[model samples]
Target chain A: MFNPPTELLPTATNQSGTRTAAVPSVGGRTGIARILLSRDTVMIYALVAFVIYAALFIPRFASPVSTGFLLLDVIPALLIALPMTLVIITGEIDLSVASIAGLTSALMGVLWGAGLDIGPVLIISLIAGVLAGAFNGLLVAVLGLPSLAVTIGTLALFRGLALVVIGDNAVANFPPALTSFFTSKIGGTGIPTVMIGVILVAIIFGVVLHLTPFGRGLFALGYSKEAAIFVGIKVVRAKFWLYVASGSVSALAGIYWTLRYSSARSDNASGLELTVIAAVLLGGVSIFGGKGAIPGAIAGVLLIGTINFTLRLGRISDVVLIIVTGTLLIASVVAPSIFEGVTKWLHARRHRRTLPQASASGATRATASGVQERK
Target chain B: MTLDTSPPATSETTTRRANGFAAVLRLREIPVTLALIALVTLTYMANPLFLSQQGVKDLLLNATIVIILSVGQAMVIVTRNVDLSIGSILGIVAFSTGTLFVTFPGIPIVLVFLAGMALGALLGSINGCLVTVAKVPSLVITLGTLYIYRGLNNAWAGGTQYFAGDRPDSFGALSVDTIAGFPVITLIAIVVVIIVAIFMASTRPGRDLYAIGSDPEAAKLFGIPVTRRVLLAFLSNGVLAGLAGVLYASRFNSVGATTGTGLEFDIIAAAVVGGVAIFGGSGTVIGAAIGALLLTTITSALTAIRVDKFWQQAIVGLLILAAIVIDRIARIRTAKKLRLSEARDV
Candidate 1:
C-alpha cells in the first residue's frame, strides 16, 4: 500500500516527460552539479583564469621578481586570513586584528628601542596580542557582547594604545640579517621564503577546520547556537579560543610586516584587516557564517594579490586597485544570492506549472477512494 | 464576578508597565548625558580655559560635522542597517565642493550645499538598492562603497587639494558666523538633531524603522513596507552626510581624496556610545548628538589636561565598550523583569 504501482507512476509522469527526467535524478547528479558549481570551485577557477590572463597580457607580471614582491606583499594578509576564515565561519568578526598587529609592532619598536633583547621583545609583543585577544574573548564570548561592536571598540583601543606606545616614532634599526631573511626567496624560485611559513599556517588551519570534531561543531554553532548547545558543543570555549588564535596569528603577521619592511611603527599593518576580510569574503565564505574553506580563502588572497600586482606593474593608479577590490567584494557576495534567487524562481515556476496536473490526478484518486469506501 | 476584581489589578499593572517603559526611555539618554556633563565639568576645572569662549567655540565646531553625521547614522542604525560609505560620501562631496569653488569662483554656497546633498542621496540610493534589491547585508555593501567611493575621490582629486583659502570668504563665513554664541554650522547640526529626533520619535515611518530593526521578519509579516522604509532611511542619511560634507569643506583646512577617510569609525562610535544599539532597534538622534559632543570634547579635554593626546582614542574606545556592556546588562534586566511580570499575570 505504501509503494505506488509502477503503472500509476507512469500516469503521473505522462503529463511531462521532461519534468520526469528532470525530477528523478536530482538526488545523485545534482549533488555532483552542486559540487562543481560551488562558490569555492568558482573562486579557484577565477583565480586560475586571472593568473593566466595576467601572465599572458600584463608586461613583466610573469616574472619571478614580480612573484616575490607580490607574495611578500600578501604574506601578512594571507597569514591573518587563515584564522580569520575560522572566526568568520563561526559567524563572528575580528576587526581588531589589524589593530592588534599595529599594537604588536608598536610594542616591538618600543621594547627594541629600550635596548631589550630582540628575543624577549618578540615574545612580549606576541604575549600582548594574546592578552588583547583574551580581552575581546571575555567581552564577546564570556560576557555575550556582540562581536561586531566589541571588535570595533578594540580596533580603536588597540590602535590608540599603539600610538601611546610609540608616540609617532618609527623604529628602523632592526638587525639587517632578519630583514633580508624576511624578503629572501627560495632558491631558483621567485616566491618569498615567508611563503613556506604561510603555507604551513594555511595547512594547519585547513586540517583543523575540515578534519576535527571541534571544527564540525563550529559549523553547527554557526547554523544555530541553541542546537549546538543541545549537542554539547562548548560554544563559549570554542569562540574564545578562536579569538585567541586570531590575535596570535595577527601578531605573527605584525612581526612579518615589521621585519619585511625593516620598520616598526604605530601604523604598521593598520588597514590590513579590511584587505584580509575582503579576501576571505571573496573566497566564498558566507558573511553570515557556517561556510568556507582554507583552500578557497588562499585562492582568494592570491587572486587579489595578483590583481594588485598586475595593476601596479602596468602603472595603473592605486585608485583603480582599490575600486577593483571593492567591486569584486560586492560582486562576490551579490552574485551568489542573485543566482540562488533566480534558481528558486525558476523552480517555483516549474512547480506551479506542474501543480494543476498533480491536483487533477489527486482529485480523481480521491473520488476512486471515496467510491471504494462507500462500497 | 472575577472581572470586577480584575479591573483594579489590570489598571494597576497597566500604569506600572507604562511607567516602566517611560523610565527605560529616559534611562537610554541619561548615561551619555551624565557622562558629557561630568567630562565637561572636570575638564573645565582642570583648565578654566577649556570652557572659555574660544574653547567653547572650538568644542562646538569640532563636534558639528560628527553630530550631523551621527544623527543621520542613527536613522540607518534604527532600521538595522549601517552606512560605512558616509565617510567616503563626505570625502567626495567635500572635494566636489572645493572643486566647485575652484572652477566657478562665485557659485552660490546654497547651490553647493544642494549639490553635495544630491550627490550624497545618489550614492546612498546605490547602497539602498544593493541592500534592498540584492538582499545583501548593509555592512558588506557599505564597506564596498566605502572603498569604491574613496577610490573615485582619489582618482578625481589626485594631488590637487582645495584649502580654506580657495573658497570665497562668505562661503567660509558659514562656519565662522555665529548666532547666540553658537557657530552657524553648529546651529545647523543642532537643528538637524532636533528635526531628526522629532521625526524618529513621532512618525509612522520612523517607528516602522524601529519595528524593522527589532525583528525584520516580523515587520515584513506585519505588512510593513520594510524595503521602502529602509530605502528612505538610507536616502535621508545620505542627505545629512552630504550636508556635513559641505560644512566640512567650510570648516576644515583642506579637502582632497582622503579628506574624510577613517571618519566612519568615529561617527559609528558616537552613535554606539550615544546609546544607539549597534544591532539596531533602539537609540535616539539626540543621544547620538550628545555622544558626538562627548567624544570631540574628550579630545579637547585630554589636550587641555596635558594628558597624552593619544589617550583620547583609547578613551573613546573604552566609552564604546562601556556603553554596549551597559546596554547588554540593561537588556538582560529588562527581559528578566518582563518574564517575572508575565509569570505574575499567569
Candidate 2:
C-alpha cells in the first residue's frame, strides 16, 4: 500500500535550497498567484482588512496613542510567538513558556529585593530561563518523551517554583530610569523603544526558520522524523536547541513585562500561553506542524492586539474579547478543511454529471470519485 | 472467535500475551498506591494528628471532587482524546447548580443534579461533534472551547457567587455526613470508580475504546466506530465533570465563574500520575482515582508536616514528570521483552 515514489519525490532537494517542492501547488497554479493566495498571505490580508475597519469605524483607533498601547500590549505575545511558530512547525509545543516567564519574573523580583544590582539580576533571570528550557529539552528531545506531557509538567513545576520564590509578593521598586526607558517611544511614532529589541528577536527567529538549512530540516522533521533522519537532519539536536531558544525568548518577554509594568510578581503573565497559542494558530500555523511563517505570526499577534484594544476603547468587556479569540482560533483551522471538502464534493458531482454511465455501478462510482478526489 | 482451532504454539503465545497484559495492569496501580501509603505514613509519623478522624475525613473530602473529575478525564484520555474544557464545564455547571438552588429555593437535589449533568452533556456533545466532524485534534478544539466556555461563565456569573449558605442543609450534608467512615461524596466517587471500572473491563464498547486509542487507523480498518466511541467518551466525561461540579457547589464555600479555574491541570496531572497514559489507550479509571487520592493526600500531608504550602505544586509537578518517565521506561522494557520472546519462538 505504500507508494515509494510518492514518499521519496518530495524529499529531493532542488537547486534554490528551499524545500519548495514540499508545498503543494494550489489549483494547478504556480509562482506569484499561488504565493498570494497562500494561508500566510491570507492572514496578512485579514490583518490589514481588520485594521482598516477598526480605523474607519472605531473611535480614537487611528491615533498614535492607540498604536503605542497596542504594540506594547502585544509585545510579550509577539516575542514568545517567534519561537512558538518554530516549535509548532516542528510538531511539538511548550506550554511552559508562560510559566517560565513567571519564574523569571519571580526570580528577578527576589534577586532585586535581596540587594542585587539590576544588571546581574537580569542576566541570572535569563539564565534561569535557559536552564528551564534545557530541562524541557532534556526530557522531550533527549529522552524522547512527548513534549505536551513534559511541558504541562514543567508548566506547573515552573509556576510552582515561582510561587516558592515570591510567595504572594509583588516587587515594584525597580529603577525608575529603566522603567521609563521601557515605556519610552522613538521620536513621534508612539511606538515603545522596547519594540526594537522585539523586532530583532523576531528577525533572528525568522531568518533561522526561513533561511537556513537547519530550518528546512525542522520542516522535514515535522513532516516525518524518519525521513528527516534519512536526509541527515540532526532532529534531536535541532529540537533541543529550538526549546532552548524558546526559553530564552520567553525569559526576555518576562524581563520586558516586569520593567514595562514596573512590577515583578509570581503571577506575572499567568494564562498567557493560551493567547500566544491562539495567535500563532490564527497566523496560519498548523498545530499538527510543518507549516507556518514568522511574519504571519507577527500579523496574528497585532491583529488580536488591535481587536482587543479597540474593544477596550469601546468599553466592551474582556469577556467579548475572549470569545472572539476562541471563535477565531476554531474558525482558522476548521475553515480550510471545510473549504477543501466542499471543493471535493463539487468536483465529484460535476464528474458524475459529465459521465452519466459511471454512476451505473455503486462500487465503480465510489472508486471513480475517490480517484478523482485524490487529483 | 474460537481459540481452540488455533495451533498449539499460537494458543500458547496468546495465553502468554494475556498473562503479560494482566501483569501490566496490576503493576500500574502498585507504584501510586505504594507512594500514597508512604506519604500518609510519613505524615503520620511527623504529626500523629494527621491520622485523626477529622484529618482522615478532610483527606477523603479533599480528594472526592478530584477523584470524580479524574475518572471522567481518564475515560476521555483512554480514547486517545482529551477534554481540556472540563474545568470550564465544571465551573459553568457548578454555577448553574448554585443558581438553581438560589432561584428555585425548594428544588429537589436530584432535579438539580439532572439539570447540571444535562447542561454538561449538551456542552460535551458540542465538543464531540466539532472534534469528530472537524477531524481536528481534540487539543485544539477543547482549548478553543475552554476559552469560549470560560468567557460565557464570566459573562453569566459576573461577580455573583452563591455560597454554601444559599443551599439547603440536606444538600450541604452530602459532603458532611459520613457513612461507614466515608463522606457521602467520597462514597459516591468510590461507587463511580467501581461501576466505570467494571464497564471498562467487561464491555465490548469499552474494549473498543482501548483499540481506538492504541491505533486509530487500525481500529477504523477493523470496523470500529471511532467517531461514536470518541463522542461517547466526551459525553460521559462531561457528565462526570458536571457531577463533580454539583459536588463542588455542595462542599466548597462558594460557586462562581472562577470556581473551577485551573482545575484542569490538576485533574490531568492526577490522571497522568495515577498511570493513565497521557497519550491515551492503556490507563484505567481505578489508577486515576488512586492518582487523585495520592495528589490530594500530598497536599494535606505537606500541610500536616509543616512543609511550605508553596512547595506542594512543585512536588506535584515533579511527581507528574517522574510518572511519565517511569511509564516510558516500563513501556520500553515491555517492548524489549516481547521482542526477545518472539525471537525465541521463531
Candidate 3:
C-alpha cells in the first residue's frame, strides 16, 4: 500500500535547507510511513492509548485527587530522571542515585532527630548530593575511569556512608508543619507543592536540552568522544556537569520522598535506581546515549504508573503483572527491529518489480549489431 | 643524562628487567592474594578459632555459591553486559527445585539438579532473546526480568517456605559432605573455576567475546556475530546462576521467596574486585572466584571476631575503593607503556 520514487530519497549533496521542496507527493509514500513507525513515535502512541484507556475505564482516574496523587508519586522519579537522562545522553550512568538519596534522607533524619529545622536539613542534603555527584564526575571525566565501574563502587560507598550516619534506625514524627506542606493540597486543586516543584524542574530540563549548546554537546560526546574533542566541545567539563546535575536531581527526589513519607531512613529507595532507569528506557531514550527527551520520559513514568495501578485494581497477582511487564519490555525492544525488516523487504520487492525486461532486449540488440559489424 | 655513565648493555638489561617485572605484575591476583593472606593472618591472631576446621569449612561452604555465580557473572560482564536477573533466577530455581522434590517424593535427587539447570537455561534464553533479538540494553531487559522472575517465585511459593525437615538427607549432604577434608561444595566451585578458565583462555568464541566487549561496534564490523555470542554469554550466566541456586538450596536445606534477594550485588562486587572491569573487556574467571572466596572469608572471620555488622559495610566499601585505585594505577601504567610502544613503532 505504500511506495516512493527512488529519486525522492535525498542524496549526499542535499545539505541545503531547500531540500523539503523536493519532497515527493504524500500518496503511497512509504518513507513517511516508515518514519511514523519510528521508536519514539511508537512509544508516544502507546502512551496516549494507555492514558485514554485509563481515563475511560477507571472512574476516579481523572479526578483531581487521584491525578494529584499520581503526579506527586512520579515527581521525585521525574526529577531524578531529568539529570539521569542527560547523563545517559552523554554516555554515562549514576548507579549511586538511590544510595545518594538514601544518604540524603539519612542526613535529613539525623539532623531533624537532633532538633534541627527542615530548611537547614534540606540545604545540607542538596549540598551533599552535589558533592557526591562531583566526586563521581571527577573520577570519570578527569581520571577517565569507566563510569559503570566507578558508579558501582560509589553505590556501595554512598550506601555505607548512609549506614554510618544513620546507624540502623528509622526516623519519623517530623514537625507537623513541614510534613503538611510537603503533602498539602493547593487549595481545591488537590495537587501538592512537591508535584509543582517536579513539573518546574522537568520544564527547565526540557528547555535546557532543547535550546542550549550544552545539550547538543552531550549528543556529540555520546556519538564520539574523539570527534567532540576535535570539535572543541569541552567533553570533560560537559560530562562533569552532567554528573553534578544527576546528583542534584536525585537529592531533590530524596527530599520529596522524606517529606511524603514523614520519615527518613537509610535504606529509603533501595533498588529504585533500576526503576528510574527502566522509565528512561521505556521513554525511548537510547541506553547507548545521545537521544532522549523529558516529555517522553514523563510519559513513560505515567505508563508504568498506570500499569501498576491498573494491575492492582484488576486484582491480578504480582507474578502475572511481572510476566506481563517482562513481555511488554521485550515487545517494546523487538518491535523496531521487526518494523525495519519489513520495510527493507518491501523496498527490495519494489525495486525488483520496477526494473524492466527491455533492459535485457537492449543488451541483446547491442550485441547483435556488434556481431554484424564484425562480419 | 644522569645514567650517561651506565653502559648501553646495562640500559638494555634494565629495560628487559623492567619488562620482566611487568609480566609478573600482569598476573593480576598478586595484590589481592596478598591482601587475603594478610586478612587471614590477622584474623588468626585475633582468634585462632577462625582457622579451625569448622571455621574453614564454613568459609568455603558459604563462598561456594557466590564463587559459582561470580565465575558466570565474569563471563557476562566481560562481554560488556550484566545479568541482574541472576538473583531472581536463583530464587525461582531454588524454590522450584524444592517444590519439585516435595511434589514428587520418589524423584531422584540427581534429576532435580538437571531440572534446576534446565529451568535456569530457559529463563536465561528469554533474557538473551530480549537483549539480542530485540536489541535492548542488557540492563533494562535484565531489570525487567529480575522483577518478573522474583514475582513468579513469590506467587509460586505463596509465602510458603520449605524447611530442612522437608528435604531428604541426600540433598543436604550434597553441601555438607567432605572430600579429603574439604567440603564437596567448595570442590565444586573450584571445578567450575578450572572449567571456565580453560574456556576463556583456550576457546575461539571466548576470545571473540573479549573483542566484542572491548568494542562491540568494531566487533560487528569484524564479522564476529555479536548478537549470537552475547546471547550465548547470557545463557551461560543463567545456567551457572541456576546451579548456584541449587547449591544454595542444598547447603541451607531451605527455600523461600526471599532466598537470594540482594545477592546479585555480592556477585557483581566479587567480579569487580577481582579486576573485572564493570564496563567489560578485561578480567579473569579465577580472579573472580578468588574474589568471592575472599569476600566470604572476611565476612565469616569478622563475625567470628565479634565485629559489628555495621563494620562489614564499611570494610567492603573501603575494599572496593582500594580495588578501584589499584585498577586505575594499573590501567594508567599499561596505557603509558602501550603509547610508548606505539611511538617506537612509528
Candidate 4:
C-alpha cells in the first residue's frame, strides 16, 4: 500500500468547504469585476455613467428642473422601498404596499371629505396603515402563513377596502399649507420638501440596515431562521416591526402622492407594487432574501427612472418601455442563475482534473464507497 | 415508513393533534357550502322565479367562465406561483378568437375553440419560460406580462369589438345551448373541472407539484426536475386560462381588449376560498371547483337581491379574508403537529 502524509488530511475534508467558499467568491466578485469593472464599485460607476449619458444624450436632462421632477416622481417609491428593502432582507415580502398606499389615500380622502382637520386626517391615515401592517404581521409572524401568499390575498383585501372607502370618488384640494410643505421646492431650486423627506429616510435606513443590531439580526433571520432564533434574535418581533415600518412608510407615500397630484382616487397607484418590487430586485437584492441594501434599491430606482426618462425623451412608445421593464426584471433574475451555473461548471471541471486522479486515496475511496452505498 | 420516527410520546401526540386539527380545518368548508345553499334557498323562497329551470341555467352559465378560470388558477397556485396575466391572456385569446371568426367566417366553431386554446397555451408558455428559464419570480414576470398582453390586445383590437352579429349562430350556441336543463357552457366547465381534478390528484406529475411547492430546494435535491415541472405547471395553467378565454368569447358573444380585465384576482380569490394554500402544496381541485361555485353564486345572489355592484367587490373581499383565516388556522395546526413530533424526536 502507498504511504500517505497526515498533513494532507485537512485538505481532504475541511478543504472542500473552503474550496466551495473560494469558488463562489471568485466567480461572484472577480467575474463580476471583469464584466462590470468591480462588483461593489459598479453601482456608483453605473449611476455616474447614467447621469453623464443623460446629460450628453438628452437635452435638459441634467437641469435642476429635470432633477426635481425625477426626485419628486420617485420619492414615494423610495419611501416605501426603504422599509420594503428591510422586510425582504429579512426573507419576507410586502405585496400590500400599493394597496396600503391606496387605502391610506382613500382614508385621507374620506377624512378630508368628512371635514376632519389635517392633524386628525394624517393621524388616522397613519393609524390605518399601521393597523393594516399589524394585520399582515399577525398573519405571517403569528399564524405563520407564508408572507407572499398572505400579502397576495391582502393585496386584494386592502385595495378593495380602499374602493369601499372612496367609492370611485376623487378627493382633491387638500389644505394649501399641506400641499405647499409636501410639494413645493426649496425656494424654487427644484428640490421639493418631500424629496428631502425621502433623502432623510434613505440615509436613516441605510445606517440602520448596515450598522445596527436589529439590522444584523434581520439578516441573520434571513440567512437562517432557526439559527437566528437560537442566537436570541426576536425573529417574530423583527418581522412585526418590518411590517409596521412598511405600512407606515407606504402611508407616508400615499400622503405625499395626494399632495403631489392633489387627488385621491381608489385606483390611484393601482399595480404600483409591481414597479416597487422590480426596483428592489434590480437593486441587486436577492428575492430569496438575506442579501441586499437600501443603497442598491435606490440605485435600482435611479436606473429604472433614468431608463423611463430616456425612453420617453427618445420618443419610444410606452409599449416598448413596458417591454424593456419586463426585460429588465427577467435579466436581473436570470443573471445570477447564469453566473452560478457557469461557476459551478468551471469548478466541477477543475475538481475533476485535480481530484479524480487521487480518487483511490483512503478518504477519497471512502467517499466513493459512500456514493455507491447511497445509490 | 408511515410511522413518524420521532420520539414515541411526542410522535403519538403529534399524530393525534395532526388528525384532530385536519378534521376541524377540513370541516370549516361546510359552513361556506351551507351558506351558499341557504342563500339559494332564500332566493328561491323570496322569488319563486329564482328556482325556475331557466334561472338555474342562467346562474350556471354566468358562473362557468369564472369556474374554469379558477380551476386553472388553482393549479398554478398549487406550485407556489401566481398568474396575474391570465386576465390579459383571456382578453387576448377571446379577442383573437373573435377576430379569427370575423376573418374566417367560414370556419367551424370547434376549430375556433381549438385555436383559442392553442393561443392561450402559447401565451402561458411565455409566462413559463420567463419564470423557469429566467428564474424570475412569477409575480413580477406575470405582472409585467399582464400589462404587455393587455397592451397588445388593446393595440390589436383598438376601437373595435366583435359582437353577436359578427359571429355565426352556431358559435353563439355554445353558450346558449341547454342540455338536461343545464347550459352547455356550464357543462363544459364542469367537464373541465373533472379533468383537472384527476390530473391534480392521481398523476405522478400532479403529486410532484405538491412536492415542489412544499419545498423546492428539497425537491430538487431529491432529484425532481424542479424547473421543468414548474414550467409545465405554468404552461398547463396558461392553457387552461386560455381555454377559459375561448369559452368566455363564446359565452359573452362580445370580445374586446377589456373582455377579461381584472379577472385574475377574482379567479385567485376563488382558489384561495376553495382552501388551496396560496403558498402551494396542500389543496384540492374539488375545493377550487366549490370555490368557483360559491363565488359565482354570490354574484347571482347579489344580482337577484338587487344589491349595488359596488357591494360585490366588498363581499368578495370579505370572502377572501375568510378563506385566508381558514388557511391560517390549518397552517398553525400543521406547524403545531410538526413541532410536537419534533419534540418527540428530540
Candidate 5:
C-alpha cells in the first residue's frame, strides 16, 4: 500500500533482483525536506514532548537521583542495544543476548561462590560470554543458519546452563570491591558510573555505524546480502563480528546488573529480550533492517525508561505498565506505515488538485513555474 | 535473516526429482528419532530405573505439555511466524479454568476445556489481526502480546492460586486415568498430534501453508489467500495452546500466574529439534512432538544419570545447533542440484 516514492529510487534494483536502494540519505537537494519527513525527526519531537509532559505532570519526574536510577536501570538494555542495532542493521538479530546476559550473571555468582578469587571469576565469565557469542557467529555466519532459530535455541540453552550453575539458589552479598564502583555516583553529580560506561559505548558504536566502511557494509548487507557481496564487502566476516560484539556487550551488561543489584540469579533479566527489542524498535530502527540511528535508539530507550519510572512513581499497577509497553511497541512499528499512507493520500489529493490547474494553465507552464515556487 | 539455500520453487518442482522426497523424509525427523532412542538406551543402561514404570510416567508427563505446545508452534513456524504469547495464553487460560472449577464446582470437565480453548482462541486472534493486518512481523507482535497477556494474567490472578485440593477428585483424575498403559493426558496429546499431522499433510489449506512459508510472494501470486491461511495457522496454534492450558490444570494440579511462564522457549526448542525450520516451510508437527519427547527424555536421562541438570539445557542447546547445521547442509546440497538443473535448462 505504501510503495516507496519511485522518483527517489529509480534503478534501485538490478538484474539479479537485489535491492540496491540505500536508506534515504539526508543530503543534497531538498535535504531539509527529507530530514523533516524522516522517522528520526519524528522520534526526536516525541522524546522532547514526552520529557516535558512527564516533568510537569509527574511529581519529582525531573529530579537528579531519579534520573540516576533511571539511567542505571536502563544500562544493560542500553548497552546491549548498541550491538543489537548493528545486528538488526545488517538485517539480522541476536535473540541470545539477553540469555547470554543471564548466563553471565549466573556464572558470576557460581564462580564467586566456588571460592575463586573475584578478579579471575569475573574474567572467566566474560570469556564464556564471548565464546557463546562466537558460537552463534559460527552457526549464523560461517554455517549460514537463520539467526532467529539458532538464537532461540541458544536462548534456552544459555538460560538452562544458568539454572545448572545456580539451580533455584540466588547469590547476594557480593563484595564491596566488586559492586561499589559501578553503583557509586560520579563526583556527586547523581550520575552512576555505569552511565559513563554507556555514554562511552554509545560514542564508539555511533562512530563505527555512521562513519566507517564496516558501517556501510552493514547498511549494504541490510539492503541486500547479495548486493553487499557483489560490492566486495566482507559480508560474512562483518556479520560474524557484530554477533560476537553483541554477545560480549550483553555479557558486560550482565556483570553490571549483578553488581548493581548485588544479587545474581539464573533468571536475572528474565524476559528482558522483549524490552531491549521494544526499545530498539521504538528508537525508530526499522525492524525490517537498515534505516536507523544510535542516537534515535538512545532516545527511544530513555523514553521507555522514563515512562516506567513515572508509572512506578504514580503507583500505577504493573499491569498498566505492561499494557503501555505493548501499546507503544505496536504503535512504534505500525505508526510509520500509517504516517507514509497519510502522506501519500495527501500527495494524491494535491496531485489531482494541481492537475486541473495544470490543464487550465497549459501543462508546460504548470510543470515548470508552479513547481519551481514550491520549495 | 534467513538466506535459504534451496530455491523457492513450487513443491512439485522441488520434489519431482527421484530422490527429493526421500531426502526430505530422511532429513526431517530421522535424526531426532535416532537421538531419542540412543539417549533412552544409554540412559536406561546406566540407570535401569529410567525405563521403570515410574520413570516412564514422569518422562511422558513431563513431555506432554511441551509436545502439545510444539505441535501448535510448528504450524506458526511453517508460516514463518512464531507465537511467543502462547505461554502467557496458557497461564491465563489455566488460571481461569482453575477458577471455573472452583466457582461452579459442578461444571462438566468437557465444558471447561471448551471454555479454556475459546479463551485462548480469542487471545490468539489478537495476535493474528496484528500480524496480518498491521503487517508487523509476528516475532515483534507476539513478543509484545506475550507480556501484555502475561500482565493481564497477573492482574487478574494476583497472588491467588488454585490448588487441586479445591477441585473435585473426578477433575484431577482425568490426568491420571489410563487407557491401556498411557496416561489420559498423553493419549490426548497423541490424538491431537495425529490429527494435526494428518490435516497438515492431507488438506489443501495445509499444503497452502507450506507454499506460503516456502515463499510468501510466490504463494500470493499463486492465489493462495496468504493472509487468511496465516491467520488460520495462528488461530489453530492458540486453540492448541489453550488445550495445553486445560491439561496443565488437569496434570499439574496448581494453576497460577507462573504456570506456563517461559514455556515458549521449550516448545520452540522441541519444534526446532524435530526439524522445523524457523524461516518457514519444511518440517512436520509430528516431528515437533517427537522433538518434545526427545528433549524431555534428555532432561530425564541427565537427571537419572546424576549429571548436572544444568548440563541438560546445554546439551539441548548443542542439539538445536546440530539439527540446524544438518538441515542447512541438506539444503545446500539441494540448492546446488537445483542450480545445476537450472543451468542445464539455460
Candidate 6:
C-alpha cells in the first residue's frame, strides 16, 4: 500500500500522453504492417533514401568494400545496440556497456600479457562482463535503486577497474590469426568476416525480441510494469536477465573490438554509449520506452554510418562530425513530437473546416500538449 | 522509486526521533569529514610529507576547481537536472581566458575573469533555453551540448595550446599567491561555496529548487516558477564552471582543447560521493565541497603512498555506489518504519 505508483507501472492513468492499447499477445507484426505506418517507418525510408543518395553521388561508396569498412567502424556500437534496444525497450538504460567493453578488453590484455592463452582470456572476460551486468541488475531490479544513478556509478567503477587492470598501457600484440580473422574480408567480397558474428547476433536478437514470448514480455514490461505484474510477468527477473544479457553482449563486443583493433586499451570505445544511444533513439525507439524494433535500430545505425562515411569523404573535420552527431541526436528527439503536433494541428484544421460546429473541441485539443508534456 | 518527497509524519515520537537523528547525520558533514580525517591520518602515518605544508597546499590547490564546479553541479542535480557540458564549458572558458591574456596583454586581471564568466553565462543560458523550451530530459540536452561545446573548443583550439608564458606572471601568480599560507584561488572557491550555500539554505527560490526536485508536479501545482528556477540553476552552474575555467588557466598554467575533457564525470563522482543524491531533492554544497576535498585528497594520498592511480578512480566509483546504496537502505528502513507506525495507529 505504501508503494508509490509512478514506477514500473502502466502509466495510462497517471500521465499526460497518448496511451497505447497494450499488445495482447506474442503475435509479431506481419510484413505489410511492419513496413507501413509503423512508428519507425521514417527511419526506414531515410535509411533507404540515404543509401540511394550515397550510391548515386559518392564514388565507390556503394561498393561492398566500403560497406565492410563501415560495418567494422560501427560494429562495436551496433553490437551493443542489439541488447541496448532490449534494455531501452524494457524502460531501462545500460550506460555501463561501453565501460564493460573496456573492462573486458583490459582483462584480455592483462591476462594475455601475463602469458595466459587466448581461449581462457576470452572466457574470463565474458564472465566478468556478465558479472558486471548482474551487479547492476541486482541493484536496479532487486534493490530497486534508480538505474540512472546506479549505472552512472558503475560506468565509473567499471572503467576504473579497467584502468587498474591495465594502467594507461595499450596491448597491441594479440595473436596475428585472431586479428587477421577479425579484420579479414570474405572471399573476393567487400563483406568482412565479422558480418558473420553481427548477422548471427542480429538474427538471434530479432527473433527473441519479435518472435518469442520473452520478447512479448519485454514489450509488456516496458509498456507498464504494474500491468506486466498483473499479467504474471516476472518483472524483476526479466529486468535482471536483460542487464545480464547486455553485459555478456558487451563483453563479446569487447573481445571483437580488441581483436579488430589488434590492441587492448583501457579507453577502448570510450564515448561509444552516446553514439549507440543516438542510433537507438534515431531508429524510432521511444526514449520513453515500450515502442521500438531492431530493424529500425539497424537502419538507424546504417544511416549514421552512411552519414559519417559521406562526411568523411567530403573531408569534413572530425570536430564537425561530432557536431553533426550532437545535432542529429537533438533533432531526432525533438522532430518526432513536432511532426505529431503539426499533423494533429492539420487534422484539427481540416475537421474544423469541414464541420460548422466543433463539438467536443476541448477533448480534441486536450491532447495537443500531451506529446510535449511527458511529466 | 516513487520519488515522492512528502514529509514524514511529525506527530509520532518515534518517527520524529528517527528523523531528528537522520537530519543530524545528514546535515552535518560529519561522515565525510571523519572519513577525510581518517584517510589523511592513515596516509600521513605512511608518508608524513603528505601532511606537510607544501603537500597540504598542493591538495588544496588541486581540489579548488573541482570544489567550485561541484557546488554549481550540486544545484543543477538538486533540481532533477544535470549539466554534462560543464567540463566542456571549463575547457572553453580556460582556453578563452588564456587567449584573452595573449590578445590583450594590457587587460586588467579582473576583466579577463569577467569576460570568461560572461561567455559561460551565455552558454548556460543557451542550455537553459533549450531545456526549458524543448522539454527534453536534461540528460539528452546536456549530452548533446557536452559534445557540441567540446567540439567548439576543439575547433577553436585547432591544435593550438596556450602556455603560462603567454600570460602575464601576475595572472599566473593569482593561483599561487598565498593569503596566510592559503592559495587565493582556494579562498575564492570557499567564498563561492559559502555564498551559494547561504543562498540555497535561506532563499525562497533555493528552497523551491528542492521542492521542484522532490516532486516537480506538486511544485508546479504550488505555483513554483519551475522554468525560471531551472533556467537559473543551469545559468548559475555555468557561471561557476566559467570561474573554475579561469582558475584552471591560472593553476595549470596552460590551456588546451582537452583542458577539462572527461572532468564532468569526475565532478559528478565527487558530488555523488559527497552525498548529493543524483535523483535530486537532497544534499548540500558544503557536503559536495567536502566530497571534492576528500576525492582530491585520496588521489594525493594514493600518489604519495605510491599506490596505483587507477585505484583512485575505482575508489571514487565505489564511493558513488556506497552513497546510493546507503541512501537506498535508509529509504527502505524509513518506509518500513512508516508502515509500522501506521499499523500501530490502526
Instruction: Please tell me which predicted candidate would have the highest DockQ against the true structure.
Output: 2
Report per-prediction Cα RMSD to one decimal: 7.9, 4.5, 8.9, 6.8, 5.7, 4.6
Tens-digit per-residue lDDT, B159-197, candidate 5: 899998987788788777777768889999999999999
RMSD of 3: 8.9
Q: After superposition, how far is residue A19 of candidate 6 from its true place, in Å?
A: 5.2
Where does candidate 6 clash, by residue pair? Answer: none
For model 2, residues A31-121, the per-residue Cα lDDT tens digits are 8987898888899999999999999999999988889989989999999999999999898999999999999999999999999999999
For residues A149-267, could you state the per-residue lDDT of candidate 6 as single tens digits? Answer: 78878888999999999999999999999899998999877788988989999999999999999999998788778878999999999999999999999998899999999899999
CAPRI-style class, candidate 2: acceptable
Write candidate 6's Cα lDDT for B218-276 as tens digits: 77766777889999999999999999999999999679978898887788877877777
Candidate 5 at residue A80, lDDT?
89
Candidates 1 and 2, the one with greater DockQ: 2
DockQ category of candidate 6: acceptable
TM-score value, chain A, candidate 5: 0.86
Model 2 chain A weakest lDDT span, ten residues long: A1-10
Candidate-wise lDDT, in order: 0.85, 0.86, 0.77, 0.77, 0.82, 0.82
Residues A287-321, candidate 3, lDDT per residue (tens digit)? Answer: 66766777777777667767766666566665565
lDDT at A80 for candidate 6? Answer: 91
- Report the candidate with higher TM-score, 1 versus 4: 1
Candidate 6: segments with Cα more than 4 A from true spot: A1-35, A343-375, B1-22, B28-30, B337-346
Candidates 1 onward: DockQ, in order: 0.37, 0.48, 0.28, 0.28, 0.37, 0.44
Q: Per-residue CA lDDT of candidate 3, range B1-346, in tens? A: 0223236446756876878976767766766777889989999999999998888888888889999999999999998888889999999999988888789986898798888888888988898887776556687778889878987888888779997677788888878889987898788889889988999866767877887788876666566777788888888888898888888888885799878987777788888888787777888888888888888887787887898765666577667667777888888898998899899999
Better of 1 and 4 by DockQ: 1
Clashes of each: 0, 0, 0, 2, 1, 0
True contacts kept of each: 0.52, 0.49, 0.40, 0.26, 0.49, 0.47
DockQ of 2: 0.48
Instruction: Give the per-residue lDDT digits (tens) of candidate 2, residues B300-332.
Output: 999999999999888999999998998898889
Worst 10 residues of 1 chain A by lDDT: A1-10
